[model samples]
Target: MSSLVKNIIRFILFIFFQHFVLDKISLHQMITPYVYFLFIIWLPFKMPRTWLMFIAFLLGFTLDSFRHQPGFHAAACVLIAYIKPFLVNMLIPQEGADTNYQEPSIKSMGGPLPYFIFIAVLCLLHNAWLFFLEAWQFGNIWYFLIKTILSTAISILLIFITELVFNRKQKFRTNTI
Candidate 1:
């Protein structure tokens, strides 16, 4: 029920789903849905940057171990983790940065707009970096761009569906003076 316990469970589940299920799905070899990054996005808003990066690295490394892709995933994860705070600040704004916001969700981050933007930017960045690294020596910019765009789109859709299905809106109480 606690944040720590919930996050631990999430970490495990995301990794399992990613490696065992999503990883096995080869959709035309271009649309690899990466819902694993959802774990990083779902982390508590107030979590320390160091811990966020560490967890992201761990998650990516674990995935790398399964997929045997060197450190591409790890690097992408760390990059996204590093920029997450800035993105959150920019998207949520000062007045909306409420302390009660536990994590980045449709309800917690306010409404669907901010939340959608937040997820889209992060997913795009992650997919771009990942596909760029994967296609580093290929020298085909068009290929890299196409793969990145397509993968990012699929990942974003999967993340949205997962959030809608699994995440529940937390009810908040307002005190009147």
Candidate 2:
């Protein structure tokens, strides 16, 4: 399938899952496990950096509109979009890359280790920023820190599980990194 089609499908799924599913399944007093940012992670590495941030803003705004959170998600999403390329490049050195590839996964990354670690880092950053912003002004430092850690860990695990179950890499091929 074309990258455009894949991204469209992913966007739709993310909106539905985040709004109707994940958003509704919050753990009472705990932070929501937000795996929606994985959509940005799955985007092609070769996608234009500007377009990535634009789409990230759009995606976050769309989700915010649904949840009525205004600019919170938008800001977090833009941050994720902004840092994605650099994180990917760091995780998988460009000089070591063997092809003008697209998307991210064990296949495109030429190994499971780099892709998984790369995505984990990005997800951690994304969730930490998101939760911290939401918890801003709250004076309970321990609560804020623990919630961020728990929520971020849960979000990352959910993302990893979703990718493994979906096997998104089946659509991409990269023999070398």
| Candidate of highest lDDT | 1
Residue-level lDDT of model 1, residues 1-177, one tens digit each, is 888998899899999999999988899767888999999998887799999999999989999998887698999999999999998888785464546567778876778999899999999999999989978977789889989899988998998899778856564533332
Relative to the true structure, candidate 2 reaches a TM of 0.88
Per model, how many backbone clashes are there? 0, 3
Model 2 per-residue lDDT at 31: 63
Off by over 4 Å in 2: 93-100, 137-139, 169-177
Whose TM-score is greatest here?
1
Model 1 TM-score?
A: 0.92
**TM values, all candidates:** 0.92, 0.88
In candidate 1 the C-alpha lDDT for residue 6 amounts to: 87
After superposition, candidate 1 runs with Cα above 4 Å error: 93-96, 171-177
> Per-residue CA lDDT of candidate 2, range 1-177, in tens?
777987899899999999999878858566668888888888877788899999999999999999877888888899989998888777775564624456677766768788778877777777777767877856566766788778878887897789779965454445555
**What C-alpha lDDT values do all the predictions have?**
0.86, 0.79
